[model samples]
Target chain A: MKHSIHMHSLFEKLNLEDIQVEDNSTLYGQANIERIRKLTLDKVRKDRKEMSFSFKRQLCKVALVACAVLCIGGATVFAAANEGVRETISSLLGISQEKILKVGESIKNKDYKLTVLELACDSYTGIATISVEALSPKAQETFFKDNIVHKLRISPVGYGLREEAPDEYRRYFSFSFKVSKELNLYPEEGLTFSMEGISKKITIPITQTVELTELDIDIPASEGYPMSYQKLYYSDLGFTLLGSLENEDVNSENCLITIEFMDGSISKFYHYYRALEQVKSDNRISVAKTQASIGRSERSVKNDTAPSDEDTIIDFDTEWFSGGSNSINSGKVISIFSFSKEMDWSTVKSIMVNGTTVRLH
Target chain B: MEDYIIIKRLKQNKEKALEYLIERYSSYVVSIAARIGGRLLSIQDVEEIASDVFYAIWKNRGNLIETGSLKPYIAQIARNMTKTRLCHKREEEPLDEDMLVFSSEGVDELIIHKEQLQFLRDTISLLNYPDKDILLSYYFWNYKLTEIAERFDLPLSTIKSKLYRGRSELVKRFEEGGYYYEA
Candidate 1:
């Protein structure tokens, strides 16, 4: 063991591990870009590439849309609302249609169009659904085909999470986020949507709130693996989970949190449904074959066999043990200032699902 | 955009230039920050360090060297900032000896090593995801074999056996790349 492998090369080779730009490193890139987008361009207000003109102008623009709030009967909600916008809002904000107050409005400039189609509100959840469509058909073609985006600084008027559309939808990009309670109040004023080299504001508003039922989920120690754990927090629209494995030996082998809602509608939450949808997509990274197939898992290494169709490569990151839960809690849980009341742990009935101990009060 | 163009824009006090650089080198910045911070800094802390690195570079744009590339400069700043954060968290003076890995190496040797490093990197990408991740994290990130085993929920023997295969794969790549290791 006197001569060992030089650790330096490996260190440097893995240098960009966190970035992995050669692959889909969007998880990190999105965060960094979002942060940089907040940095003001300090240019003319007309071009929004991350510049804010007057706050008053932003407000007045949204206010100009007379029917910022659309009145739809409970049964006619789907018929009255734009399907694309409704889906975008529900998917983006992790809200249900019932929670929306106003939707389907637009503002545009010469380059891109911005529309706020759905606004869901709770006392604190002000999730706005906004869509930006490029004016040029050629630009839209490239966007849809290549999945490349202009270095536009698109910021929600509030503090919220952003979920961008897929490549095909990039030309008519849609996003939703939970904004600050203050920002929610001014939803009529759309966000400052800026392009890589241009800028503009889109006037629209989506506001309505749903009080999701919260329950205390209690788990017995036996439910978790020696070092693996799963916590599923549910709301009306969807649930969230914080799955972690304390045991480092597992290459993320076992993480299960199956949900059973009172309604057979597991599709109620956008995030959960989306994950299932992506896996359903023909290009999904399918589950890997168990190395223990022959009771000799080491064969995977020795034979150096090309991975079988049964053994798909898992591009996994152990650090992000959290998944399956929808983006936001049941419904409009956006807004920094909105705080929902907690569930009383004592009132829930304890139950079991697949040997996982759970308290469902 | 070219490095020179970005530098020129930064010099002109255009904030978007900084944004462009951030988008381009974000992965590089994150890797450096996480490496230097190790397990000491939280994600928030590491993020702040990365932000500080970019801002520091932008702040001192006038002093940048006009040759080569800005990558090494950015890496140096990122590592230094991370070290500062680590020192603050540990409440100790910077340990220069621990910071230094090798006292010196021949210039030619260094050059060859960097070249070979490229070979290692390409091979890393070529390897399947699981094997690549196992080798890189175990060797580069300083994660213990047991730690990895626990994290991935694999048995200890399985990890060691896989690691042995990973090393063999490494050796195979070295031979293929026209280099020999003194094993």
Candidate 2:
């Protein structure tokens, strides 16, 4: 409480009103304004084009899913017809064909037919591919336009769905769920994928469990923030980096994670998803606070232990595909990076964070 | 143009909205950058900062719709961008001994308590108009005494005297409020 106060610090903290001054007409000429306008407008156009391209790519991916669903007509010819789905799942998850559990479980009502095509999981994450075919024409007409998909919920509360494609008769989607105490899908469990009116609890067939590889890391301090790599869990599904930053004001953007593959390819974990923008628009800081409090209460209830003084979960995932907790509270930070395509961990030559590299043989 | 209309057009990615923004706020941004950087920054640097501020507004158009008014947001961006430019310049080239304001006092480090800072803010709010403006311009905005004098159309000696009186009043208030500044 008793400390010497720097004069500059005092000046920096003062929040004063904007100084009212006469117009300095000679400052910026018409040419300067025109130049800035051109540059900014060009950037705006470029961003719009990029966003359009991204949306089209998403639609194409959805089409692929719809095609996979059409190929597998019924549950009777499940193994033979679901080859495309199996291959797609295999490629998306970076797993082998054998690891995918083909559950062509179909249930129908008067309005729709929902089929669970395939599923893949580890101890920390699970992926399920599903198809919802509109049996009624009315349902088909409103399928792509409405919030019908949001009504469909999975038991493990934190599951997120991505629409692969929507055709005249059906829509294909993939659901990714993170493992929690309430829902542990690994080594088999009864998982329920339900809609508002129709629901089903299907037995998640036992499959291979992807072992997590821990990387030996030592990240040196940089930019006044002293950081120490606590743990690194790597798998084809994704990688999670648990570390601590001594400075409480460390921004999540500064904690850069880069993976260098043996094929001279580099993957940087910094891409922000459109959903994240939506989150920010909806006041994400308050949402983050709510999630943090919920996480604390859940941890305490599950283990019958008190919550840590400053434990919080911060989602830093680009796609929000998985529950990647990029938590930073009282200097403890955890960053999770989920891969969209096949990443051969064995092919990873090194992982660098904030200019510090840790080689993996 | 109204802020809402400009924000709507900006969200729609209309180039005219950006043109309007640049036409309206370029001078204001320039004034802020000039005042903050003073003699340390060149005219080119100030111009670049103004351009960057507009570019930032374009990049963050999605979040602008929620901001009821655009001027405050633009002012904040201009201030931050100007400070960042100055910080980078300082790192690249060290300040001269004559330019160091507090280095000669032999008081190396000071930690201002949060409570005291709040009290200082409250006291500063209570100060008279031109005196408060002069103090803020000199200390907070980093405006040179000559620049402050020219901006307010007062002599350099008058600007210096006003700053001295402002500092004395702040110190007296701090002591009366039971907050002591050692050395």
**Local accuracy of candidate 2 as per-residue lDDT tens digits, B1-183:** 787888865654444577888888887788777655544455677777888899898777657765567888888899889877754211122112112111122233333345556656766667765676677666666666666688677998997788777766766666766656443
Docking quality class, candidate 2: incorrect
Which one wins on DockQ?
A: 2
| lDDT of model number 1 | 0.39
Highest lDDT, which number? 2
Error of 1 at A196 (Å): 3.6
Every model's TM-score: 0.27, 0.39
Candidate 1 local Cα displacement, residue A340, angstroms: 23
Task: Output the worst ten-in-a-row residue range by lDDT, candidate 2 chain B.
Answer: B94-103
Candidate 2 Cα outliers beyond 4 Å, as residue runs: A1-87, A91-94, A155-161, A180-191, A199-208, A216-228, A242-254, A271-282, A285-334, B1-183
Tens-place lDDT digits, model 2, residues A1-361: 4444444457676543433322232343323655655665666556544533333333333323332332221100000001111124664444666766788887777777877888776544556788888788888777777555555544432222345436567777665544422212222454656565675545554443565666545564454233555566666665655566665443333333445668786655332212223333552221110001001111111211111232332223221123233334445554444444434657867665555556665
Q: What is the lDDT of residue B173 in candidate 2?
A: 66
Full-model lDDT for every candidate: 0.39, 0.52
